[model samples]
Structure formats: structure tokens, C-alpha cells
Target: MSISADSIKAFYKDGFIMIEMNKGVEIRFPVSQNRRLAVGTPEQLNNIEISPFGLHWPELDEDLSFKGLAAGDFGQHSGCPTRNRRPRAVAGR
Candidate 1:
């Protein structure tokens, strides 16, 4: 994992730092062990989310779920950009 000094600094402070990658360039960090995830528009790509090992695009209002990503289908989903923050929990059917 290639990390810059600034990234290191953010990690030390808030435990995370977003990295805005340039368009057309291959992402250095592994999104999910070789599976490259790219947002279609600059509005999507402009915001970067850097967690301990996850990213959250706030502009998109989408929580990029990453655990057990490749093994299941959720990882392959490109969530639609949303602006609502309503609870999505559902009761037992």
C-alpha cells in the first residue's frame, strides 16, 4: 500500500483521510483485492472516503460497503447517488 505523508498525518489524527484520485489514472490502492470500483461521473469521483479499510462518499450519500465484498453480490453494486437520510430498516415480513 503506497501512502503519502499527508495520508499518514490524517490517519494519525482522525484515523482516516480521503484521497481524490485524478481521472483516467489507475487507482494505486486496491479497492477490493483487484476488483476496481469506479464512479461514473466526476461528481462521484470528486469525493473520496478513506477509513481504516473503507470509503464513504458523502456527496453520493452512499455507504460503500466493503466487508466480504468479492465473495458476495453487494460489493458489485454501484449505489445510486441519493440525498435522503431516512432510515431503511424493515421489520420482519
Candidate 2:
């Protein structure tokens, strides 16, 4: 329910606050205005590149930037980075 000096220091440094509130962490990785890499305390937080403002899911093998996530531009689509809007399919192709 509370945070300490040491942990707070780590928070600004890593941008991800590891809080023991229930079965998860209050991680706000990616210090962007709107981009927040929310993940579980133990599992979801890891497995990705630990950045102060971003994360890389090794299992998913994907990376996400703050701006990208904010604008919803990039992310895992069919296990790959795809456009946010669907491409128009040809008619009667």
C-alpha cells in the first residue's frame, strides 16, 4: 500500500515500479505521456527488453515504443507488426 525511497528511486530509473500489491506489480514502463507498458509483477513485466519507456516480449518476440502504443500504430499483428487500419482488399479478386 506504500512505497519506499529505494523503490521510488528505482521507479524513476527503470520507469517501472515493482509494487507488492496483491499478485502483481504496478509497472508503468515507457515514460511517455500516454504510453504505459503495463504488465504483471513477476511474469508479464519480464520476458521483454527492460526499458524505462518500453518493453520487448521475448516470448511474443515483439517490441513497442511509447508513441507507437499511444497512437496505436504498431504492435503484434498476426505475430508481426501490421498497420492499424485494414488494407482494402480488391473487389472480386
For model 2, residues 24-64, the per-residue Cα lDDT tens digits are 43434343221233332335444445454554556445565
RMSD of 2: 11.5
lDDT of each: 0.36, 0.41
Error of 2 at 74 (Å): 4.4
Output the lDDT of residue 76, model 2.
40
lDDT of 2 at 66: 45
Minimal lDDT window, size 10, model 1: 8-17
Question: What 10-residue stretch in candidate 2 is worst by lDDT?
Answer: 1-10
Model 1 agreement with the true structure over 1-93: per-residue lDDT tens digits: 333323421111122223333332222322332122343244444455655444555655544433432233323333433423587889994
Candidate 1 whole-model C-alpha lDDT, 0 to 1: 0.36
Shift of residue 62 alpha carbon in model 1, Å: 0.9
